[model samples]
Target: MDLLVETFFNLAIMREALPLLLRGVLTTLALCAVVIPLGFAGGLVLAVLGTTRSRWKRFLLACWIDFFRAVPPLVLLIFVHSGLPFAGIELTAFAAVAVAFLLNNSAYYAEIVRAGIESIGRGQREAARSTGLTATQTLTWVVLPQAVRNVLPDLLSNTIEVVKLTSIASVVALPELLYAADMARSVTYNASPIVLAAGFYLLLLWPVVRLLSRLEHRIAG
Candidate 1:
């Protein structure tokens, strides 16, 4: 532990890499900030479609979820960044990374939302319908509001996952936190710089996970 502290202050964090690493964190956070919400939106749409009674819609939605969930987001990132241009759908490096995360995170979020929706007792829906509420109205007023609350903890937890997943974007030449670490390591020929970068991510993420834990506990309680 002392060695870690010394390495942190004596080597990378003490050197000029602090600001560069901060820039990496900024980029990572920015990428997630955009993609996380997009993922939730996509996931919500997917969940709604998947829960529909139509077999065709459920099958199609399941196909989409399975495809995205099966493929690694890193592979998707590479395809978007390098492969898509061959077909004329060009995307910037940032756009590719963002789109990949948005799609991947959405798949996971859909499952979370679906679980929340399914947890609702069947009586609630029947009760709403018996009150003369339309299907859309019952879903909007009775189902979604309660389901969203039930799923808030899952959503917060997934935000942490989104933050971690941004590291994969580095392989596509996006200058996320891990990429900054690699750059610093290359220049310094030092492992400490890379450790510092990891520390930065942990430092940023730990508190978030802790807060999410509390939120989850509160919601569960």
Candidate 2:
């Protein structure tokens, strides 16, 4: 209790934890900021591929989706960052983590996008084709617009997942939130920094979460 009071109320505590914790928050946010957009891009690409008419291509995409979805993010990070040596392409921790996060998110968003695309009324596609639209044109101008609007809620939720998953990157010494907290504890023999770190994450995450929830309600309504 006293430790909490000292940690929360003391200027010394703030001085010590603030800088390190802020760095952690920033690093975590950076990781997510990069991964989320990349994930959306990858997901859209995969979704488009999956929607193509080629049977063999769809099979390959299913395998790609299953492989990433089956593998844990931490394990995938290791395999990509460190275990790819046998393939002669060793990736940096940042590269490996970003790739892993993006791929993981890709599987999820791809499925969501697939659902969104399918959820579009069949009549819309027929109407677009009747108006002299090619399949690609129909998809780009007609199907995608409604699909994106329909799936915005799912996309935002997935973005939150991408943000939270950055904690797993600590295992690779990515200098993200958990890594920063671990470093602080190691240096100061204090758990207070970690507590502060938790507060910071919640502080950062709360507004986004609330906004997402609000958006979900608005869309659902």
What does candidate 2 score in Cα RMSD to the true structure?
A: 1.9
Residue 12 miss distance in model 1 (angstroms): 5.7
Best by TM-score: 2
**TM-score of candidate 1 to 2 decimals:** 0.89
Candidate 1 Cα misplacement greater than 4 A, ranges: 1-9, 12-14, 219-221
Q: Please, what are the lDDT tens digits per residue for candidate 1 over residues 1-221?
A: 87756654556343767777788889888887888889999998888777789999898888888889999888888988899999999998899887887778889999898988897888999999999998878878998889988888888888888888889888988888889878877776556667888788899899989988898888778
Winner by lDDT: 2
- The reply for model 2, stretches above 4 Å from the true place, is 3-11
Native-referenced Cα lDDT, model 1: 0.84
CA RMSD of all predictions: 2.4, 1.9
Report the C-alpha displacement of residue 67, candidate 1, in angstroms.
1.1
Per-prediction TM-score to the true structure, in the order listed = 0.89, 0.92
